[model samples]
Target chain A: EPEVTQTPSHQVTQMGQEVILRCVPISNHLYFYWYRQILGQKVEFLVSFYNNEISEKSEIFDDQFSVERPDGSNFTLKIRSTKLEDSAMYFCASSKDSNQPQHFGDGTRLSIL
Target chain B: AQRVTQPEKLLSVFKGAPVELKCNYSYSGSPELFWYVQYSRQRLQLLLRHISRESIKGFTADLNKGETSFHLKKPFAQEEDSAMYYCAVLGPGTYKYIFGTGTRLKVLA
Candidate 1:
């Protein structure tokens, strides 16, 4: 079965540095999303992208966060400045449409030092 | 606001025993509910959706609008059913999903 794939399974970055997490969603999927989970917390939604634009975002997805679909297959999330609290497991998901079940990637573990 | 609640953090049952994972939601509008599971070292994957009304891996869940709950159930559990399960809901007109804290089910042999 086709699945969503994320790059840089794990990343370590300086507190003030920028980090970009990349994902390649299922080829035919039309809606993409980013979610994060603090070590012991529930998965939290960050943002959703469709048609090259953001459909919705949460308060957790503030000014420092940005998402881009630079190419047909790549969906990337960039954090302008990483904070200690920014360390978490980031997951990328996609669905054929809004009502469809979303498929998730293995997730990228981001660590801020 | 849309919210999903999975009351149990951990549940353990012997193999061949019946299993049920509880889930509840708070949403004003119509909600689309789903159950996602993650086995050790594996990615989170969809187990079942309320709309599909289909059983997978001998598990099934029914969307109870009156109770605002969508609990997953299995007639007989197997050791391989051990995993973390999450209940999620998507409110109408939004792409964002609200996920529950999750329940870790361990089917002991």
Candidate 2:
């Protein structure tokens, strides 16, 4: 079965530096989403993308955060400036449609110093 | 407020014993409920969906509208069933999912 793959399974970045988390969703999936789980916290939704535009986003997805489907298969989340609070396990997911069960990637563990 | 709640942070069950993971939610609209499992380092896998009403891996969950709960249950547990389970709810017209804190299931042999 096709699965969403994320790059740099683990990332360590210095504070105030820009970091982009990359994900290649399932080939035929149409909807993409980004979620983060801080240590000891539940997974929190960041944003959802479809049709080359953001369909919805949470308050956590502020000006500092941006998402782009740079290509047909790649969906990337960029954090303009890393903060200590940004350290978390970032998961990328995709689904065939809006109401379908989402398939998630292994996740990228981002550690901001 | 739209939220998903899993009161138990951890649950333990002996092999061949019955298992139940509780999940409760508060949503204004018609919500979609799903049970996702993560085995060790593996990614989250869709275990069951209330809408499907089908059993997967011997597990089943029935969504109760009046109680506002969707609890995952397995008639018999196995060692392989040890994993972290998360309950999530998606509200109508909302593309984002509200996830619960997650319950870590430890099936002892």
Candidate 3:
């Protein structure tokens, strides 16, 4: 079965640095999303992307965060300056279309010092 | 806002024993309910959804409108069934999915 794939299973970064997480969603998926889970916390929605633009975002997706579908297959999330609290497991998911069931990747574990 | 609750953080049962992983949701509107599972060292994957109404791998969940519950259950446990189980709810008016803290089910062999 086709599944969402994320790059760099784990990442180590320093405070004030920049990091870009990458994901290649299922080829036919139209809706993409980013969710973060802090250790021992609930999974929080960050943003949703459709038609190559942001469809919706939560308060957590502030100025420092940006997403781009630079190509047909890749969806990327960039954080301008990482904060210590920004460290968490960032998951990328995609659904065939809006309101459809989403498929999630294993998740990229990020740690900031 | 909506929330899903899976009260038990851990549950253990021996093989061939019946199992029930409780899940409850707080949403006024009729919403979609799903049960997702993640095995150790594996990615999170869909275990089953309420809509199908068909058992998958002997696992079934009934959406109880009166009680606002969508608990996952199985007739008999198997060692392969050990994993992290999460109950999720998608509100009718919103696309954001609210997931329960999760219940880790361990089917002892």
**Interface root-mean-square deviation, candidate 2:** 0.5
Residues B53-85 of candidate 3 have per-residue lDDT tens digits of 888889999999999999999999999999999
Candidate 3: pairs in clash: none
Candidates in order, TM-scores: namely 0.98, 0.99, 0.97
**Candidate 2: segments with Cα more than 4 A from true spot:** none
lDDT of 3 by residue, A1-113 (tens): 99999988999999999999999999999999999989988788899999988988889999999999999899999999999999999999999977788899989999999
DockQ of each: 0.92, 0.94, 0.68
User: Which order, best to worst by lDDT?
Assistant: 2, 1, 3
For the second chain, the TM-scores of the candidates in order are 0.98, 0.98, 0.96
Q: How good is the docking of model 2, by CAPRI class?
A: high
Model 1 score (lDDT): 0.96
Interface RMSD of each: 0.6, 0.5, 1.2
Rank all candidate structures by their DockQ, best first, as comma-separated numbers.
2, 1, 3
- DockQ leader: 2
Question: For residues A7-104, what per-residue lDDT tens digits would candidate 2 score against the true structure?
Answer: 98999999999999999999999999999999999999999999999999999999999999998889999999999999999999999999998999
